[model samples]
Target: MDVFEVVADDVRRDLLLALRRGALTAGELARTRSDVSRPAVSRHLRVLREAGVVQSVVDGRRRVYSLRPDALAPLATFLAALTPPAPPVPARALDGLDLEVRRTTRERRTAHGAAQQEESA
Candidate 1:
């Protein structure tokens, strides 16, 4: 599924926004948003991890999560390319998409490297 579909949930958006500020533990994230339960937050985190939108590292007993930053680039690039130039979609919006794709591409590469390491280990 595309990053848009994966991030369609409100909970996921909140988590992503939080990560944008900096990395946080699951419990910290749960405390940041009361609309979603702690368990629900965990589930959402899992989904984001699977989508390569977030990365988590074990910090003692907690898993500290942060935005992947460039994980959504492939989707963003695909969408940007599909946008019709003659449709007046706004150059500003297209520029934003271009930036997003560049960022996501970096995250995608990092995630791939991590996955490869996991497989080797």
Candidate 2:
């Protein structure tokens, strides 16, 4: 499984989040979540390990798991490539836009004779 597939599981994602703080034993990880059984957590850990999302090593009789952030580089790079660059910002604000609108309206009213009617009233 790729890192993305391994991380698709809710249980696996939670395990990754927990490991982000630091490495933890399988037992410690299992204890953090009551919804998943220890065996299930172990299975998720194995998947993560195989996908290179996490690494494990023996600490005497037990194993400790830690995140491998480099495993996500491909996904990050792919995303960055897909994202379009931001549109260029305008050089200046349209400060005279309201004034231009008022001038246009006045010219249109004068052409239609409304300006003369308003002035005589």
Expressed as tens digits, the lDDT of each residue in 1-121 for candidate 2 is 8876876789998998999999999999998889999999999899999899899999999999999989989877888999999987564555477678899999997777976787889
**lDDT tens per residue, model 1, 37-118:** 8999999999999888999999999999999879988767888999877766778889989999999999999999999999
* Top candidate when judged by TM-score against the true structure: 2
Predictions: Cα RMSD each? 18.9, 12.4
Q: State TM-scores per candidate.
A: 0.62, 0.67
Error of 2 at 116 (Å): 71
Total residue pair clashes for candidate 1: 2
RMSD of 1: 18.9
Residue 116 of model 1, lDDT score: 100
Question: Highest lDDT among the candidates is held by which one?
Answer: 1
